[model samples]
Target: MLAKAFYPTEYKKQKENSWIRVCVRFLLLITLGVPSNTLGSFQITDDISKLSVLKQNIPRDYNISVSYVPKELAGMCWVKLNIYYLEESLNELAKKFGNVSSNKNDIKILIDMLQDMRLPLGHLDPIMYDFECHFRNEQWQTEQYFDYVKDLLKAAEDNISDDCDPPPCPTTLPTGKGFDVI
Candidate 1:
């Protein structure tokens, strides 16, 4: 009754009609390319300095620093860092939800994706090695390095699944006071 008062039949119909019109127009615009003016301006550049500036914009946490990475290594380091963070997040998610049968397949897909990514990430290790050996010793800050490695190791240990038992799936349908029949 209160919903009817707030949104009368005529108003609801008009609102729904407007929404449908919007969706149709959007679909039409997609089917027919949008006007050039709507896209605004875009430019491609091979400028190295501009690349460095763009690289600076990549997000970072306290544990990772890209500011001191050499220009040649900046891009590879960024990729490695992103993969590391993604693998960490997925592992955490797996630890939390992978026991659920429904989530196992999705987690496996993510793990497979990570494995694929590790190929490219492995190729970039020479860049990382150069950065660590040649550039890092001089430019890299070490104050938090030990703490960061320690935390990373601890997280790795926590995410280890070998020690944990998978949750058991029920063969029979559940029956209890709280269970409802469909």
Candidate 2:
């Protein structure tokens, strides 16, 4: 019975190095003492606050302004309004007035907005997208949601160490090594 209970099929399958990596990440998280939920807090706040600024900048009657949208329905319109906000910010920066120096503040805000936009392009998207699909389904399943949460945890763990390095280009080869065929 003990041998049967300890069988490989009954155990969680993971790469040999995976537990070491998990321990290191777990220790790193503990050492930092930062709650996992707060990982994207700053970026999320920056994204939300930009809406108010964009709302204030655009005229109330402006066609693309989301100011008129109800707060309850905001999620439905968020992505569209975010794109419009970027465009409107760029347009504002492009214009020059008699007195005001073409709002450097707007340019800074735009840069932050672009960074916020790029944040979602990180590796967590596929897991989040899967979660989204499950969330949208008419049938609710607790087991699936639990699995989604686990996947999300793993994705967050995987992404926690990402330093956001730029991709290799024709001009730049990766720094590590060249393979030698035996």
Q: TM-score for each prediction?
A: 0.27, 0.25
Pick by lDDT: which candidate is best?
A: 1
lDDT of 1 by residue, 43-68 (tens): 12132122233223322332223122
lDDT of 2 by residue, 35-97 (tens): 434565322324334444544554444432111111132333223223333334344443532
Overall lDDT per candidate, in order of appearance:
0.39, 0.37
Off by over 4 Å in 2: 1-42, 65-107, 119-182
Worst 10 residues of 2 by lDDT: 64-73
